[model samples]
Target chain A: MLIMKNINKIFQTADIQTHALRDFCLQVNEGDFVSVTGPSGSGKTTFLNIAGLLETFSNGEFLLDGEDVGKLNDNGRSRMRNEKIGFIFQGFNLIPDLNLYDNVDVPLRYRGFNAKERKFRIEQNLERVGLASRMKHLPSQLSGGQQQRVAIARALATDPRFLLADEPTGNLDSEMAQSVMSLLEDINQQGTTIIMVTHDAQLAQRAKRTIQVKDGKVSELENISRQHNQAIA
Target chain B: MLETGLILRALARNKIGALLIALQIALTMTIMVNAIFMIQDRQQQMQRKSGLDEKNSFYLTNTVFGQDYNIQAHLQTDLHTIRNTPGVVDAIQINAIPLSSSGWSMALQHEPGEDKDAVGTAIYMVDDHAINSMGLTLVAGANFQPEDVELRKEGQSTWPAKTIITQAFAENLYPDNWQSAVGKTVYISQTQPIQIIGIVAALQAPWNGWNGVERSMLVPFQRESKGSYYFIRTEAGRRDELMPIIEKTLAESDKKRIIRRVTTIEDTRERSYRQHNATNKILTTVVITLTLITGFGIVGLAIFSINRRTKQIGTRRALGATKGQIMRYFMMENFIISTFGIIIGCFGAVALNMWLVNTFNLSPISFQLVAFGVITLFIVGQLAVLYPARKAAMIAPATATRTI
Candidate 1:
């Protein structure tokens, strides 16, 4: 559902220019689950931002749902991001002032949904993430896994076309991380494309496709199902 | 529509900041209320009535020759010459003008019946022609005749003089009946009991209305008319034309005796009002300065508030709040603050007005108009907050998501 061709990103400081992404290229079809694995400062987050229309690339062509993103202004980009992309951060990034129901209702409000419609969508998403009973609870009141579930529910509440998760389980314990990974798999099974950036190789192996990024460029693009037998061996 | 719950939660997160905003708005309302009061005071001063029809009248002081010489002949000649001048309506000489800052007076008293007792009252000396020249309307009795006060030479008979009583003087001793006091007897001294022939209304120049004493009496200025001034009434739009003629008439006779300070009634009125205008201008400057300070204060506070609540604002923005929504949020806060301030300010204004009325005997304050002024102050507070709210609305989601 998302495509990039020869994307280049550069960051400038007062006395130095840094190339964050050089000739970066990627492609993901509809309902594809992709995980981008890389070490620190490997331009993985920059690539994800470009794909999500959160940041612009210096030189590149990006096609989101077959619409050229380079021609859009900031407002247009924001609208597209709101409508088509959902973000999941490792830290959960929930508004502390709001409870889970309102937290999930936030993005849905931006989509111009009516109150009744937003309520229905939020309830369904919360139930799907197994937090329907705790929808009124605050993020601080929930456990780490429960908070992550609420974050996932918020992301899914807008019914976005794709999900961009940066280290989705980085802050969670092993048990919570595995539960969150399984939750991602179940979400992918329902045909929502997810591009995750994770350093855990075991978690990366669960995705349908794995792309390894190094030194601001993609080094490998491997098909996970084709290597499943080798992993089982 | 934005979720009201979110706005409340956002504001509740920073109670102190919200209170700060309210406090600033309240202060602005207070300053604006007083500023409006000062403006109203200025407008009232402008509309105050001057007791005489001074528009067509002009006054001139003769400084010709020397101060000690008798000016009766010179004054008569000047009066006749002024009457002959084109556009000259009427001219007369009087020992003292109404509402003049400095004048000579003798104590007078009123008696109940057979007694000749009276209290001290201001006495003015005027020629018979002064009644017509000054356009003084008599409330009762007849005008003084010229033959009554006309001066006689050596070995000539004394003129029979009539007295004019002012309304204020008539009010005293007579109580509520001003007309009945006309026929009553009053004496300038215990011996000289002048029969009151007529009663005239009190007259004031612009500034003299504030003086506590209002009683004035008119008598004849005969041989004793020393250091007197001339009052001339010109045709409805002709004072400028008549001025040159009077100047020439004075210059031809005693060239040293120039007519100093020849001014129309409007000039005097403007001079009287100038003090109030200057005060109003200073007040206006102060109001403007205060408004700017208030505006800057609100801007600074709003920016700080939005910054401190950056995440909350971002959450609101991410929740689909338009820039207009954020603007209304802050404006509502300011509105509440202004409303509270205005309520307090109204009470303050009342207390202040009471103090002023008691201490300085100032006029009473109008609570209705003050309420309107306070409402206007609320509008000003909103304007002050609009800029900061817009900046808050434009905060980036990326910045909000990042750790503080």
Candidate 2:
């Protein structure tokens, strides 16, 4: 449900110009779990930021659910981001002063949901993430994995159509990472499109499709099932 | 409303900063209320009307410098020359002009040697023309007749038999009704009883700060001595033009006597209230300075809070908060802090006013003044918080969320 054609992103300074992304093209259909793999400074996060409508590209044609993203202003972008896109940062950026329930209630608040609707969505999402019993606990009182789960619940509270995750399990242990990955897989199976960026090859292999980025360009694209079959043949 | 709860929790995390700002606001409110009240009271006091045509009259004060000078003859000649001068309406010799802050006072009783507490009243000695010269409107009875005019020589203590008392002075003597005081005989310091032949509408004395400034009386007497005061009334809009002419005439009439001062009654009134005016100005300056300092204090605290909560702000921005929402959050935070301070300040204001009322006898603070102070603080709080809030709102969501 997303398309990008020949996207270009440039960062300019006083005496130098750097290309963060150039001639990048990608497409993902509805109900797909795609993973982006790249080294540091390879424009992976830039691509994700642009795709999520958080940053603007210099020249591009981007269509999400059949609407041109390049034509929207700041406010329009914010509305689209709030209504149709959810984000999972590597930092698990839950507002520390708020309890878990209020943390999950942030997106719903910006979405202009009434209190009853917000409450129902927050509880349901927290329950889905197995953190409903600790809704009153603060993020500081929870472990990294729990905080990430709360972030996921916050992202889901708006019932976004597309999820953009950047290193969602970067700070967790192997067991916690596996649990988060499995939860993401389950969410994707429920028909919410997810695009995850990861450095781990094993985590990237878990997705239905993987795209490798290098030198501000997409270098490879592979289907896991086809790769598995090719390896057997 | 949910934002308010969030703001409260955030403020709870920075209790010391919030309390300091609140205390500053409270102090500002207290000082502002009291200072404004004192200024208004002083302005009202200054605006009290002196029962005379102050704009069209001037006073010439002279002191006899030579030992062989004939005081009465020179006074009569100077009076005649000034009266005959162009634009001169009327002139009379008196011991002191009204609002000169230098006059005589005496205790009055209904009868000679009476045992009741005597009422204090300001005394003025003037001739038959003094009533019209000073622009005093006689409300009852009549002005002093030519036969009632008595010439008081040096060392004489007894006053004239007929006197004109102000309505305020009459009320003091006969509290039941001032009209009854007319035609009644009142004793001055166990001397000969004098009849209140007339009553004037209103006459403010020189010392207007006294509780009984309006209590004054006029007696028909030609006060000619070493020191004399000549009050000359000019035609409408002619006092300023005739001041120099009066000075030159009086100086040439008697070279032995020195013209101590030549000034208008308005100037004399201004000189009398100089201290009160100075106090009002000082209080106004203080109020302005305190308000400015409090506003700066709020600005400093708001900037500091914005800096400290930058990450939280960024997180909210990324969670789909619009720029307007971010700005409103900071504004709401400031509003809560200011409201708390104002609530505490209201009690402090009342307590301070009560102390002033008890200690200095000032008027108590009114409800309108308290509301005014509250609204002023709210406006100042919003204005002070705006710059930092706008700065916070302009932060880019992409860059802010990249802070990890």
Cα RMSD over interface residues, candidate 1: 3.3
Candidate 1 wrong stretches, greater than 4 Å: A10-19, A58-60, A71-73, A96-102, A117-150, A171-191, A200-202, A225-233, B2-5, B49-57, B61-78, B85-87, B94-225, B235-267, B309-379, B400-404
What would the TM-scores of all predictions be? Answer: 0.74, 0.93
Report lDDT (CA) for all predictions: 0.73, 0.87
Tens digits of lDDT, candidate 1, B265-382: 6777677667777878887887778767766776787787777768666545443455566667777766665565567666676676677668866677776667776766676778
DockQ of 1: 0.24
Candidate 2: where is the Cα deviation over 4 Å? A225-233, B109-115, B171-176, B190-192
User: What are the TM values for chain B, all candidates?
Assistant: 0.80, 0.93
True contacts kept of 2: 0.36
Tell me each candidate's i-RMS in Å.
Answer: 3.3, 2.2
Docking class of 1: acceptable
